[model samples]
Target: MKKVKRTTIYDIAEKLGITASSVSRALNNSNQVNEKTKELIIKTADELNYKRNTLASNLRKGQSKTIGVVIPRINQNFFSNVIAGIEEVTYQKGYSLIICQSDEDHDKEIQCVNTLINQHVDCIVISVSADGNDYQHLQNVLDHGIQLIQVDRVAEELETLKVINDNVQASYEAVSHLIEGGYKRIALLEGPQNLSIFKQRKEGYLKAFKAYNVPVIEELIVENAWTKELGAEGTRKLLSLPHPPDAIFASTSDFSALGVLDVANAMGIKVPSQLGICGYANESFSEITSPSITTIDQFSVYMGNTVANLFFQEIGNNDTITKPKIISIKPELIIRGSTKRNG
Candidate 1:
């Protein structure tokens, strides 16, 4: 199939028998151009279906007036809400967004970042992929003088603007709640330790155990159980142990916790009484489950808004040298039936 050429000011100029500069001036509503010529140029532009090159225009002014956002997945509730929040602010500020999803692949994430960079976007906001161990692409954004903002999952070594949840504290609260609820022999389904967020969450879980004087059982912790399928697999193994845990914490996400619940129900294990469950990231389905899962509300939408606001605030500053800023939002632990044994 042949590509259709986009109509430009030059095409309008050629059709109207006028200079391209005059056509450009008229299209931009310049006062120098007479009303008659402007009217004619606009009419011709409409006929030709001419669209203004906003990116080129903004680039001439040393900006693109556009932001690029990269996420692991587009369908996740938390990510979609965050995108909505970002769009809300960016639209109001007359800025557009170019969204890309890495599908949790490290290579795809790098490609997305490079594409955004080549587009000459003014800012790049990213929640790094799970499998990404190298961050040269992120550093390249900074090298190219593009404003970079890391949200949710991030590489801690880079001194860039970041908006994140207090994962450690949130995890601590979740685990502490389980301990207080008389659920001993608790198990943890943890995500990949390569990411700082997951590492922080593990730290919090350990802290809670220390606070309560609960002996940490190394055998009860499952690694890389961040997804629903992995969570279910881990749950099966845990339940099959000689001394199965009475409670399980899916520290990765609500989806993982849902997996735990599914496995428990299948085995006829009663929630809260025989097996308690807790999850991170208060996904919408968490509240609607038969036995509503106890989870942490990350305030994902608010986090997105905060990231945009931070970009605007930092860009407005005229300082030659700026220190990296980190904003941590405290997540709320919502207690539900999944862990409410006494209730």
Candidate 2:
């Protein structure tokens, strides 16, 4: 099959008996061009199906009007909502977005960043995956002179515009909530400690214990139990101990908390009576659980909007927003039946 050749500005200009420069200026809506002539040129260009080459235009302008976003998993609700928020703000500014997922692999994350760089994206937004450990890939982004924004799960060492929740403060509040409800022995279903988010959450739990004068039990804490299966396994191990925890904080996510709730039910432990459970991320299923789990609402969508607007503000104002700026959004704890111990 023969390929259809795309029409160009030169073709339109020849057909209209005008210079290619005039056609180009008209297509770009330049004010220097006469309104009537510009309209005529545009009409002729449209008739000829002249489509401007964005790459050539961007090269001439010295920057692409495209932003690349990298996420661990695009299918997750939180990340998808964040992407939606980013699109809402970026599309209105006549910018394009390119999305890619790392699938929780460090190598893939590195590859994704390199691909974005090759594409000449003006900015790159990312939330590092759970398995990512190296920083060279991230450093390469900054070294290339492109704007980089890190959101949610981020690299702690890199100094960039970071839109993140107040993980420590929020976790402290969640732990304190359980204490106020008279749950003394609390078990933590912790995530990978390498991530700053999980470490901060652990800090909050410790701080709350110190504040309330409750003893922190090492035996009650489980490390690297981030998924539902891990949560369930950790819960089983903890409950089988001589003295089981009266409450569990699924700091990894709500899905982990759901695992705790299921295990507790199977063991005939009454929720909010014999066992209290809390989770993170405010996942939709948290509300629909048999006994709704108390969780932290990270305001993922709002965070995305904040990130997109931050890029625009820095780029539009030409300000020196140097020194790896960090913006922390406070997260709210949603109290539900799972953590309500008494009337």
TM-score list, all predictions: 0.96, 0.90
- Give the distance in Å from residue 163's predicted Cα in candidate 2 to where it truly belongs: 1.6
CA deviation > 4 Å runs, candidate 2: 1-5, 10-26, 29-41, 319-321
The worst-scoring run of ten residues by lDDT in candidate 1 lies at: 8-17
* Residue range 175-251, candidate 1, lDDT tens digits: 99999899989999999999999999999999999999999999999999999999999999999999999999999
Error of 1 at 155 (Å): 0.4
- The lDDT, on a scale of 0 to 1, for candidate 2 is 0.91
Candidate 2 all-Cα RMSD: 2.5
Q: How much is 7 displaced in model 2, in angstroms?
A: 3.2
lDDT of each: 0.95, 0.91
